[model samples]
Target: MTVDLIAVVPRNSRGRGVQRYYDAQSECAFFVSEPSGQPELWHRYLDGARDVYRRFGVEQALEYDAVADGASTSLFFAALNADGDMVAGTRIQGPYTDARQAHALVEWAGRAGADDLRRMIADRIPYGVIEAKGAWVARDAAHRAELGAAISRTVLHGARLLGARYGLATVASFTVPRHEACGAMPAERIPAVPYPDERYRTVPLWWDTRGYSAFAEESQRFSTQAEQDALGLTAVRPLDARCGAGRAAESRRGHGR
Candidate 1:
């Protein structure tokens, strides 16, 4: 049997017996193809994220303010229980614009080679951060662990899929603390958290890391050696194709997938 979440997937195959909102498939599960058009899924994702943005290191007021200013494309999603109860809500933004379809313009701009750290704002390009709102996991410690893993697989897969098609080289996010209550405010003076903390959420985000590279120049910067080590990030040389003329696009394309 297959389970579709938010229609981004048309059918995902798995075994029966609902646990933690996802059907068990002998411990192996997969998402079905996106049933609907991609644009609709993108909008649906953004709407869900907008519903609750404040608690997750994401500043609702700031994000909305950016939207009002001129936001474009964004990513949004929800995790649900077997009863279809919402377990968590979040959105990763792209760009914002008053025009209803301006999000596509933002995508074009990014693929055309715009500055990621600077141009990719909620108002001008796309929202950089992914925010979780009203998030919950099974109360049992064991169940919670599984819940995090599921989220990692799903979210990472979703983001990577999007980034690959768009020619995006990197992804940036704002995570919240792991153990803080779902509604906890971000700890920084900027009034947000970086991402879900390592304790509650997995220490290194187990998703997305496999697909895109950090922007390097402007990623969530770490000052201390400990912070650097914890994120498990390292610098590597550019791809071999980048050195040659005819293969730059192909090289980047291969790296993205």
Candidate 2:
């Protein structure tokens, strides 16, 4: 629950060389790894997400099997307390080759803004796009807001590590401002969607990795830059060459979207 955080440090090399960092502000240790390769950690993340989603009465929105398979997840982030319980987490889905590959597009299908959502993702595909999903924090955790903010910053961290220039998220209206503090902007032109039975108005949010620093809060900017520096990334690299080449071919075939 504390906000006076320490520097990011790698605590161990277990779980297929899982990376760990400390957040003094939140009083928690954060872990990053590939989902499929770390079965124990992967299950911990799934369980934590499921518990939080169920508490919010939006458990139906989660696709358990799809998430469990871990085939599409490129990076997973988890936060644990001193006692070693998973407290907060999120996963990055892809530097996708197709717009339809995003769960948001699937959730928007048959809806009014479906096309707009597709186009939004398609336009960013060539620049490297990733969907940050399954984000959650335990309700009983101390310093909930601070912890949540810390988790939000990981979206940018994960995107940069994966060579992604843009990241997308479909978050409930209430959490919009929290994400925005970390540089996510709502797609205001598109109307909100009533998802998981209408109790929630979910809207699409995007982060332009190249310029998020200009919009992020000062503390957030400092924290993000510190984390990136710890990872040895002096600057944001361009989209991975493989992703660029593949997208070019996909665009030529009119399948980029």
lDDT of 2 by residue, 107-140 (tens): 7888988898888898888989888889999999
Query: Candidate 1: lDDT over CA atoms?
Result: 0.30
Which 10-residue span in candidate 2 carries the lowest summed lDDT? 2-11
Number of the top-ranking candidate, with TM-score as the measure = 2
Candidate 2 stretches greater than 4 Å from native? 1-14, 237-257
lDDT of 1 by residue, 1-257 (tens): 33344332323423122112232421222222221223333333344445444444444422454543223323333454443333433333322232233222232233322232223222322422232222223332233444443443333333333442121211123332321111112111121122333223121121122322222111121211122232232432333544454564454343322
Clashes of each: 28, 5
Against the true structure, what is every candidate's RMSD?
Answer: 13.6, 7.5
Quantify all predictions' global Cα lDDT against the true fold: 0.30, 0.78
